[model samples]
Target: MSKKGFAGFDPEGLERAAEAVRELSQSPHAQSVIQLQIRQQEAKSEEAKALQKERELKKITHDHEERRKTLQKNLEINKETADYNDKLERKRHTDKLKLQDEFQEQQRKKQEESIKREEKLKRETMEHQLKIEEKRLLIKGKVDAEMYRKNHDLHKQELLMREAERRETYKQIFQLNFNQLSLGFEYLMNNPSFMYKFFLYTASITTAFYFSRHSIQLGKNILFLRIETNLQKKLYIFLGSRYLESVIGKPSLIRETSKLSYKQFYKFPLKFYKQVTQNEQILKKNIFQNIILAPELKDNLQIISHALINKKKHQAPLRNLLFYGPPGTGKTLFAQQLAHSSGLDFAIMTGSDIAPLGSQGVHELNKVFDWANKSSNGILLFIDEADAFFRKRENWNSIEKSYGRSRYKLT
Candidate 1:
């Protein structure tokens, strides 16, 4: 009973049980049952392992997908950042180019200004040098003329001194002869025939000298009168006959009353008139018929014509006119036509000519106005290129300084 208590206490029984267990394990039915149980347990274990492996695979796949998405996102972010940086860099490059262009433009403008200034300075310097050279030449010419004149005078003086010495020696010899002839002269004084012959010879010589001097003076006076008459006639022809007649009196009266010396009448720096040849094409033609003009300008011309025609009836003074336009617009032609139509003497002068005469221009202008004032008949004074000397003071340039001075002198 004690041995039966423990299943493998007896060695034989334990061996038999082991043999039976081995036989049962080797039996077809028992082997089949055991194999089925083992298969079931192996299947369960394989199923659990497959499920764990599936879970692990799903977790790894999820992690890989998440990582892929993160990497794609980072790639997209990097691409966007790179594009933004490229755009910023392009913008900076464009701005830098623009700045460089602006700086270059400014430099170019500054360089142009510098070049212009240099050119102007060079031109002014050249003009100044030329003027100085001209003055130097003029002074040198005057000095040379003075030296020549002094030498000529000294030579004449020397000749005169030699003649005087000869005359003195002759006088001394004559005085000595007269002293010797004193006694003979006393004897001849008693002879009335010799004394009468000597007196007659001296009177004849005196009369001849006086008559010769008178004839020469008369001839000179006649020549001068003829010249003055010719000059007067020329002046009358040049300056309209009406102007001379109105200002200096009738031709016949002028001739009679012109007793003043030639020097007094013919002053220096005389302003001569230029003869204007009549345009056969346009002369005596209607104002509107020959020339092309704007409608407004035509109307203005008509109005001005009417006013000028009736100007003598009205006490009001004639209105001054200013013609401003492009060159070759016939301002001068129009002025000439107006003067012709109005029966006024037209005198044309250039302002450029007056600008060179500094202070002397003032006297010249005064003379002109004075001459004009003397005309009882109206005179039309046309100043061409008026802006040469009459430019706005505020707009004066460096070259205009001399012109400005001339303008001041005129004023």
Candidate 2:
């Protein structure tokens, strides 16, 4: 009761405050404030969403830039690597070219050196051969000179001996004549009748001398003719003249006998005719069997005969024989008989005949061998007086002192 009386204090203030809260809750201005607050909260949420979207876009751009930088770095590294590889390839190519050039140069130098060495060796060999040839020529010249000198001396000696023989013959003839004249004078003095007898004797002697000389000459001529006839017949048989005539329809020119005498055919020595005639006579007589020989000589002959007969079958070697003995040992006879019995052609030549020919002697000797080879039958060459020509070369005197003399003699 007193609440209204105290300075207007209301005893229902708590209830009135509650009633005011209920009225404010129903007011339009309060509802408007609540809606504005809700709108502000939605705006804040949208702004946060936009900021998140912006951060995502920025992260994408940053990632793209980093990827681009990495790509550019890779491109630079690849280009640098390519450049290094190209340089390396070029260096290798240049080194190969250099090596190839060096190898080729070395080969070329080796070939040139080899050629030079070969040339040098060839030159040395040729020079050595030339020197040997020169020495041989010098030796040959010396030998020729010595031979010429020896031959000249032999010829000179022969000439001197011949002159001496002629002189001796003339002396003997004159001495005989003088002695006969002296005896005639002595006989005339002893007896006057002896003068007439002496005249008759002289006439008889002169007549006898003339007839004897004529008879001897005639006999020689007859013997020579006989030998010539026999030689012609032998040549006709040996040369097969009948066969040759049949083929040629005429006589062979070689078969025609020469009418020339010894004097006309002076080139052939008289000994050549004598040897030919002697050989013919020995063959005709068949004297080999009649003649006696030493046991060794007979055995040698038998051996030679057997060898000759079996030569073609056995291929036996033929050796040269040397017969040295005193004169008249029947060496020539045996050789001729051997040739005849063996069916071999024989050529006889004397060393004296060869000496006169000088250098032509060698040529004639060669011709003899060549002709012998051409014969269908084998040939036996008999060189008489071989010792006169085939003396030891060591025994020959030097040619220096006798050069001019030898030259004159040769000419």
* Top candidate when judged by lDDT against the true structure: 1
Best-fitting candidate, scored by TM-score: 1
RMSD of 1: 28.3
Local accuracy of candidate 2 as per-residue lDDT tens digits, 85-109: 9999999999999999999999999
lDDT, candidate 1, 148-171, per-residue tens: 887998889999998898677668
List runs of model 1 lying over 4 Å from the truth.
1-285, 392-411
Single out the weakest 10-residue window by summed lDDT for candidate 1. Answer: 267-276
Reference-based lDDT, each prediction: 0.66, 0.64
Clashing pairs in 1: none
- lDDT, residue 47, model 2: 90
Misplaced by over 4 Å in model 2 are 1-39, 141-411
